[model samples]
Target: MSKYLDCYDYAAIHAQAEHVVKHRKKLRRDVVQKYLDWFDTHCATSKLRFQQAQEVIPGGIEHNLANNHPFPISIDRAEGAYLYDEDGNRYYDLLMAGGPTILGNNYFGKECAQFIIDKAPLTGLYSEYERKLAELVCQYYPSVEMFRMLGSGTEADMIGVRLARAFTKKKEIIRIRGGYHGWSDQFIYNASEAPEDAACLNGIPVECFQSTHCVEPNDIEALEQQFIENEKFGGTAAFVMEAIGQDSGAVPLTREYHAAARELCKKYGALLIFDEVVTAFRLGMGGAQAEFGSKPDLTIFGKIIGGGYPCAGGVGGRREIMEMLAAGINKNRDKKVRVGGTLSANPLTAYAGCLTIEELAKTNAHETLAKASDYFMKEIAGLTEKYDVPALVFNHQSILHIDVAGSQHIPTIYKKDDPEFARQSKEASQCVMEFAMALAAEGTIISGGGKTYLSCATAPLVDEILGSYERVFKGFE
Candidate 1:
């Protein structure tokens, strides 16, 4: 059993979520503008850089998560728990490089550089470090009998679904609504803020989502129904979800739900796929499956798997399912799921991943990270109470959610043509963005205004982190 199992209080999390849903709140428009002005005045360098970037990069950002209200702050350097912007302004980095740097930024830079110096990153051939990384993963995650590296979380998820279909000879995949399993065409269905299935298919074809189905998080009944429905064409290939819940516990899951879902997959003959991109290492060394005591048939990993480096994604599972990815030239080709990436599990990333897992084990860093998250949750609760702000703050270990606007709690199923629901979602999203801008101006970085991924390095900055939240809460209407 993992020591971090007691790190979460699901009862408290659900109660707080209900309370916040009943009393949604956000900062006043004037207060939001006040912070936006801070960016315009204080972030001259970043503004200039963003303007220059817009000329080359569409929307002046590479990752969708980097888009801020005013403009994305240009990060010049990142040390432990803090990001130094090009304007010389320092901010507490609660984003944690979008859920990768668990030991914190640049924690083992010298070691990674030394490994790269020795191994030169890639050789278009297998590296010993890849096997070492796979061994470490299999050692910690009991569900992962064998591991296969890939290019990104999207690629990993793509292959996971494909492998499930090949292994089970099934077609459809069932995903929890609003759970991001990467931007792949099949998984992108039902991802919009609205409940309707057609809202997000701007570029992707409608037929791509035909084999994909959605269920509200923790709705075991709905999940089982989807599996039954998929039997018309083919049995559900996989039930994929973020184990904690969609958007890193924006809609949290219950332990009962986890246990039931696991059983349903067994009954329905569907592979259970946990997208542990954010929760794998940050939750604990054994990942959320171990923490919850519910084992998944296949697990999707990203972020910390490469130790905060690029090309960080993979799929691991029972040896039989994983062996379908074996490298061969048209040998049992019909039964194989083909996947390839020149840079996947290259020397540097694989070596760094091994080092990260070793360091995490050596120092027992996840427990420290959980403590820091617990502290953040407490401070946030205090601030919200003191200001009479109805906000939900919860965590699954170090993965934190601060839903001041309560956008995430909005119902997953709603009328397709309901203008009122659309308006509410738009307002909530905009307000969330503005709220994040306020926090940024106050020198704290959070993801999409509500989620904050913390690390072991966050322990020392707990007070400072809360100070930023307090300032933002104080500006509430």
Candidate 2:
């Protein structure tokens, strides 16, 4: 439906995925050992700090991305395209603070810090900046005539799902298999590539997944079948997915697929929800929905929404559906979604979010990011070829996905209960983690060794990063 996505070659991406799965590759054991040795030698202070942190902090990390092998590198400071570790080693940042720093780290921190100094962080009440942030979101996201801010992406997803159920008066929620909405109980049903496998349900009860259904990405027939199957029960509430596939486009989806999904939702009387947590402003000011030319009934926002600040999540959509989250007394309390957060829409995050969006529009950051990513992706293709590796690299604008070992697609390749599945999955995961370590050792950082969230500020580092990838590739087995 939209030519904006012509830049992405889905056929090439799928071929890459196939190649990696059929012939999985990883860093050589000696090469991986060398990378580990480098971490032990160069990141002495970071190792010490993480060891100290283990006494109190679980896994010596607050974020999952920080859980790296040989202990995570403790960052002392971040500026532009680099992360300065406590050990004084500076690495080029391609993670972009886990996909929030679109304009780069601390781009608008000064203004936001000044705002915090003037107005404080929280007031436990209304703030004009909250209205301003919501207005900014609504202005860009055409599907969102109204918006409601939340504390994090998880919270936003929780409420978005609730709003869908409330609006449709249904009990079932359908999500793409392997798609992650959040850590919320209902939404985390199928968090892996395995269809209907609630593998992450440690503390979550089995009944929490009753109303959730999983469908593989790009399977329009499977999706429509699930909706039809739901009709025998309570009918479908919503069909939610990461527009570009799971793990932020680790498996890419096409515009034709998205358009079909949109129509199916309408035909089945279910709302189409786009989980744009990582893609929101990164895809464009208007988001993935705008680029795809398909309007979702509700859109979830996070990460860049708060401009890399806290309280960075929201759900926005058509007025009638969003109005279900309205505050104040209501006689129809049972009909409305009950949502609340003490720190949501606080002064600090709100002002920063507003400034970030304004800057995104003013600076034309997307154009810069697009050009930079084009260069980066081109180089990655060359590196993969030169290394004689089965890896694949592709991008949805600035959100670049480099499938080193095809770990993200493992569940799709192997049955979850297969005897070889566990072994293959573990090996693939290790390969990915090791690859990420190799990149970090080469003065580059990415998300779990697979995903890279580039920013306008990181555009200048394209050549440097290409070199970094080549160095890492040289160490591959």
Candidate 3:
């Protein structure tokens, strides 16, 4: 039998579900009430302040992702791997601003932030920092010959599709199922379960996805079949996808699959685009393409490049295609793509991005961060085994996924005939949610969607985090 099954059976035999419930009961209501009361007396003040702000700020939070259950923790400050909540609650932060802040918050160098604050945020003109950042990015990703900066990953993905259409003179684009390129109209299809048949977000015209196609990851036959059918309908422009499935929980594409994809794109007369917004510097200095040894026609990047700041994204690749931006090919005569934003390549964002990349390169921070992530995965696995819990941890460098009740061991994508496997997988995802809620109450803020990230984390932080997991899991015992 497979090693996964062996591990599962061993855990099943030793598992005591009551241990988890009994410990949970020990920390139940009364115990939680005492802390809640104390928090109310101390922490409720900030909660009130944020609630008042909500009248003007829509959700009382700048980013929807920051708003969490029990109301969001109004963070007073953060340093390294820790966040200081308004109530003086210090907790380990695993979300890391949804996978940015590789060097952690407030570490983007005081000098850089100060310079931007004094000089200005946006100049609406070309700045030296933009050129410097582009140069740095090109040094690492040689495929990016001529690149254009944008405001967010969403914008980059949108513009990337436009560029592909402009270059290839084709309309249709292919995306993998469950891959989230962005909230844009063209590339938003098949992202989630929606009634729209195409999975396109509301407000998007149905025609936007008429040419877009969806394929399952790791399924070479299905991918080729889509290409064959798409060609009959006027050919495909590009195959855009996250090089390392970030939103889908770090589900890596096999080397053979990526290689096959590159060959297929060439065969179909379509451009290949790698959406590296979350995978960029996190996987390595060269990103997923470098790690996987596959070359694509275009690439999109964000997140770590911004160093936790806003307005970070860009598209880069073959000179012939990227130079189209300068060649007046965007169906506009002003020699500019119709897609320029007031804040695209803003001075402040550029400065932060440059400094962040410099730090990442100088210290080899990605390697260290990967080590911390490895430690985290191993410790979590060991803890699950020791506690006889059916939890599994999977990771790629700094990104991680927690699959409670054996979810990690199951294939997320399976053949249609494999109903038994699908049923088991669905149950495992449900179990993950339960364990995640419990972990959150214990003061560790992992992503609500069962994902986590590590940044500038040290060995000591790993030990502390694992200890917390051990304590929390022991309660399950």
Q: Please rank every candidate by lDDT, starting with the best.
A: 2, 1, 3
Model 2 alpha-carbon drift over 4 Å, by segment? 1-11, 193-198, 330-332
Candidate ordering by TM-score (highest first): 2, 1, 3
Scored by Cα lDDT, where does model 3 land? 0.71
Among the numbered candidates, top lDDT falls to 2
Error in Å for residue 298 of model 3 = 0.5
**Model 3: per-residue lDDT, tens digit, 422-472?**
666565554455455455556676764566778885334888777667766
Show where candidate 3 strays beyond 4 Å.
Answer: 1-64, 193-201, 246-249, 326-337, 405-434, 458-460
Task: Summing lDDT over every window of 10 consecutive residues in candidate 3, give the lowest-scoring window.
Answer: 1-10
- Output the TM-score of candidate 1: 0.94
* CA-lDDT, candidates in order: 0.82, 0.83, 0.71
- Residue 390's lDDT within candidate 2 is 76
Give the root-mean-square deviation of each candidate in angstroms.
3.3, 2.9, 5.4
Q: Which window of ten consecutive residues has the lowest lDDT sum in model 1?
A: 1-10
